[model samples]
Target: MDASIGRTAREQLTGRYVLSLVAFLALVYGVTQDIETVFAITLGLAFVETISILRDTPTVDSRWVGVGLGAFITIASLAWFAWELTTAAGTGGPVWFPALTALIGVWFIFDARADFADGTDSYAPDDMDASEMMLVLNHGHLVVEELRQGPKTVPELADACDLTESRVREALDVATDDGMVYPVDGGPIDDVERYALDESKVGGVAFVRSNGKRILRRIARPFRR
Candidate 1:
């Protein structure tokens, strides 16, 4: 299962790199002949990338910022395209094009910075406890945080954590044994078991509420070195 997951991740990374290369080449080609086409294609690629990022990191602030930026870029690109179409052939565009493009470039830079700020580098620890610590620091906390809102079945937890149901079940089992999570009544489901955080446990609740950013940095510490 681990090998299969690694293979799937590799395939996805390869595909993203290839698509990015294609988009970059297309943008360069469009720049030489049709500036409007460049804007349209760039906007499309930006939207695609934004959607991919949001899927991987479904945080509320990131979602709102990404959507706002995407909407603005889409509207600006469309307006520029329309202007180009209406303008007479061989006539130049407005003087603000360069300034607007520069602002957009800055936006991209900030967007990338934000992604890095919220993202963590992958790490592989040899020790079993180390591995478990990393999981509890990241995915485990995420699961508990989600459950803090309400109880959730395995499938719901998996979806919330962007993990497989089997993986979520395994994590839940461990957490249950540790007395961090408890089985709750499964609503409308006969066989499925729902889980919730045991708020009565002070340590568990504190760990669930711990600073996520700090935990992510700790996870990436070894990798950074």
Candidate 2:
């Protein structure tokens, strides 16, 4: 399962890099064209292909957007170039220069729209912990501090944080998984009399609350360094 996830992530990263490089090369090539027609074709194709890869979806909306932007860039550039050619022949100003300059503007607008709709880097709730704000003020740093003071059972930690015992255990579980806290006697210690909790399980609530995304992030973070 992890291997499949790693493969998918790697493919996406590779596609992003390749698309970016293609876009860059196309844009550079477009700038050197004399008629600006080749520039329009190259620029539009680059934009479409780049955005399609970024989206990684073959949805109708995605296809329509790619087609529309490509057509718009090509048509608008050619039309402007024709007009510029006629004007320059009559007035003797620079031919293709005006069309080339306007193509830059068109490229910018298309790229901006693509970026806005890309959805590649947008934040989802899964990117952050739903319980993080409530329990851990700074990614459970305070909880870790409380744990390091002593082996305060789940209830003491919960009461200290003014949260439910379940919440405290949740926080401690996060701390434990993060290597900030570990079980003292190789496992949870019984303290049902002083602190109300299922002594057998220390971080059951935390583990339950955490979804797949958070767990993966935790596992990957260590390797990122």
Candidate 3:
């Protein structure tokens, strides 16, 4: 596999998020009984989606618009929740749930957004790590996302990703290629392998953090001149 990055952007959208939106909509409706609130929340998320698309990838150079928008929205939602909480007749009961959901949702988006921006250049020996990182992010994003929650077998990953078992296996292979994940019991991952997240990865968390610092340095370089 080519270790050089072949794509300027890493994917941020995936099936799990789609599932989340559907589930969130139902939960909000169940609690609020208000189409207006549902619309409001959905619209807010759509806005976040737009942000994820434009400013949250390796192609972007330290763009903060979408991330900042997410922060603003979460803060605003929490503020609303707080106000409602204090009122005797406050809709806080309803607002609190969505508000909390918004906080979680924003965080979820934020985490993905940051990760999508990772470029192996700043964090790892690109010649060695880039190809593997590319495979996992491009082909196994959903798989990796779920694994971050904990270890699982191919069937479990397929179910979570809404992909077929065969497809999940393929992605799992990509994940395992660069040690992104490994079987919980150790050794080569087999057909029934249960995989867990490899936290020491140079191509994931540290990748994103280093990318952030790289961007910050670039931004500050001009000012320092």
Candidate 4:
């Protein structure tokens, strides 16, 4: 039971499951004339997939992949409904259904884009070089991203990063020492601190804020004049 080999196997299994789910949904839509059934199945499958992603053990892509798949299904559902509306005319069905679906589709597209962009850094810790390792280990860069929205307890951090409590604490301490996070005004019992958004003069300050968070103060590097 080599760990890396097990992770590779899990990755392969997840990929296969995602592909099969996508294909099955497509087939069902193509073969079935009922829009309701299509929507129902898609919704149910998306829910199940989301839950599976969230509950998946370490080494899986988790929520990011679920978000992407959900987005794809949302867009497809919208297109299907829109076609139905156009072909059958207003009398065929309610126009709002398609309209609502279209909105959901657009939202999902935005969500998927953001999720993919965020996950570009989702490699295992061993694969990371020094800079990335610093982010994961010393700076809480990834943890900040995960908890930037609110305060998270140790368990939450563990679940998010697929690491144990001790590791999460070590990382969190580094972040706190570096001033990335601190106790929120009214947060969890463990002096839970919210990860502040880095408002540094660094170019990514704006990007971080765009995703929504309190602007973080800059940690001036020595090289900067």
Can you write out model 1's per-residue Cα lDDT over 89-203, one digit (the tens) per residue? 6237664674465456445434444455657322111235666767755777678788988889888999989988877876776677647799977667575788888777537
Candidate 2 local lDDT, 36-153, one digit each (tens):
6556666666665545443443232343443455556667666667776666554455657656755654554454354456543221113335565554545355556565456666
Model 4 global lDDT (CA atoms, 0 to 1): 0.58
Pairs clashing within candidate 1? none
State model 3's lDDT. Answer: 0.65
- The full ranking of all candidates by TM-score, starting with the best, is 1, 3, 4, 2
Q: How would you encode candidate 3's per-residue C-alpha lDDT over 114-149 as one tens digit per residue? A: 444553122111343567566546658788888888
| lDDT, residue 44, model 3 | 78
Q: Clash number for every model?
A: 0, 0, 0, 3
Task: Flag the better candidate by lDDT, 1 or 3.
Answer: 3
lDDT by candidate, in order shown: 0.62, 0.53, 0.65, 0.58
Tens-place lDDT per residue, model 4, 1-225, is 246445544664587787897888788878997778888898887665444434344555544554555576677667767677667543467667766776665554454455466564222234455776665564365577777566777777778878777777767776665355665544465465444434352246644653344322211211123
The weakest ten consecutive residues by lDDT in model 2 span: 119-128
**How do all the candidates rank in terms of lDDT, highest first?**
3, 1, 4, 2
Model 3, C-alpha of 1: deviation from truth (Å): 33
